[model samples]
Target: MVTPDLTTSVAGIDFKNPILTASGTFGYGLEFTDFLDLNRLGGLVTKGLSAKPRKGNPPARVVETPAGMLNAIGLQNIGVPVFLEEKLPKLRAYDTKVIANVFGATEVAYVEACEMLGEAEGVAGIELNVSCPNTEEGGMIFGTDPAALGHVIRICREATKLPLIVKLSPNVTDIQLMARCARDAGADAISLVNTFVGMAIDVERRRPVLANVCGGLSGPAIRPLAVWMTWQVHQAVEIPIIGIGGIMNARDVVEFLLAGASAVQVGTASFVTPSASANIVTELEDWLSERKITSVRELIGGLELPPRG
Candidate 1:
């Protein structure tokens, strides 16, 4: 039998495979060189980059939950200029694609970061971390408000010629509306279910587990919701979708594909096993070959449903 093909294209960029490491969990991609060959995976998204470096939140920023974890790291990073000057050059040596994740507290900040990354080399695309709050708008999250979401995407869309992928926030009443907003505003592709808003408490101390009081929830816990949103967004827009949630193995990756994702990102799983993303790339190939699946693309939106009674 011929080897299964895992290659996929999103937002006009060709990926060797469908598995790219999620932003914060994967660090700068160079950090994992000792654990796995970076060239083996489809791509890697750098930590959230802003116009300037941030000190992030104080201590107690993360906590492990039942089947997942909650984090409010405050999008800390070395800033856009520093990443371009220091990291991008080193990453250019690897054969894999490098996607930069951009974050901002306001619309202007978003555009600034996009412009900076747009001028840099070795970046295949820009994934907008719109899940951030819009300080200019009284802290309204750009991803939750349809109008705000569209505005930020439109300006950033104009700021960069590279592919623009808007990562959606799940804490909203209408996810499909948000997806449509992203597409109509000129997003090249969409990545869904950034993280569910959640919080944990210490019964004895009677205080929030994370210093930020509330944090984003990620892991297998959000997989079902993520898949459902992926399917909903698939029906809402024509652009490609990169599904994200509790994907621990190839089967989980297959679940998102069947639901309507051209590709998927591995987030929390990387924390459990540094090589989780690379392992999934190989496991996905093995999974398809065992079933005689010629190309992984065949699984996209292949979910079957019962006919109406």
Candidate 2:
């Protein structure tokens, strides 16, 4: 079988492939070591980490929907100090690239979080989770307003030399405007469709299924919308775009790449299969090889649009 080259560069950081474990879905990337070779995949994005340890939201935080899942985990994490002192050392031993997913309620909090990750060794990049719908104050607030989004991006840009990948929120009127804002503010790259706001209820009890009442919806249910949004952002910005939101198999990854995504993140699928990310990497290679494609780059933004009427 012909070996197709899967390595791709995003925001100056070179990844072995375009597959990355989405933040929040994959714990610290080390948890799955027993299930899959951590280095066999592209990269690992740590769960959303805050300036300080967060207790997260109350119990009953997750619920299964029709074709997706809703989660209001509230960015629960071990905080930066513990992550650097404990997780970083172990992650550095692996050959895979590690990207820290940072979040905060205030601009200072965001800057501080990035600054902490910036000083940590073995971190290939930083993915600002500015659109987390689970948070009470910050999260989506920093991602919705153009001015506020620009402000946060600008602040974090100065806080870290690591590739700054701004993960965007889908809960907005114009995601294109926000994409442009991140690019104009000096973001190295951007990831999109952080999970659409959704909710579920126990009809018999007349109460919300999730303790938070509302949470972010993810999985196949949002793939179509995610692809559309990724395409729109691709048209609006120049920086590398990492597509997120219901990607499941190798074919789904191709759809995102055709829509102009430099890479793609697998989230909810990980919950279904521990080795989903690594398996997708293999599937992608096989698919490319079968078509005599030498590299994944050829398919990036290669979607052929129908001629205008």
Query: Which candidate number has the best TM-score?
Result: 2
Local error of candidate 1 at residue 58 (angstroms): 1.1
lDDT per residue for candidate 2 within 69-186, as digits (tens), equals: 9999988899998999989999999999899999998999999999877757799999998898987754689899899999999989998888999999999999999999999998
User: TM-scores of the models, in the given order?
Assistant: 0.97, 0.98
Best by lDDT: 2
Q: Model 1, 50-110: lDDT tens per residue? A: 8889778786988999899998887778999999999999999999989999978889998
Off by over 4 Å in 1: 132-140
Residue 297 Cα positional deviation in candidate 2, in Å, after optimal superposition: 0.2
How accurate locally, in lDDT, is each candidate? 0.90, 0.92
- Which 10-residue window of candidate 2 scores lowest in summed lDDT? 130-139
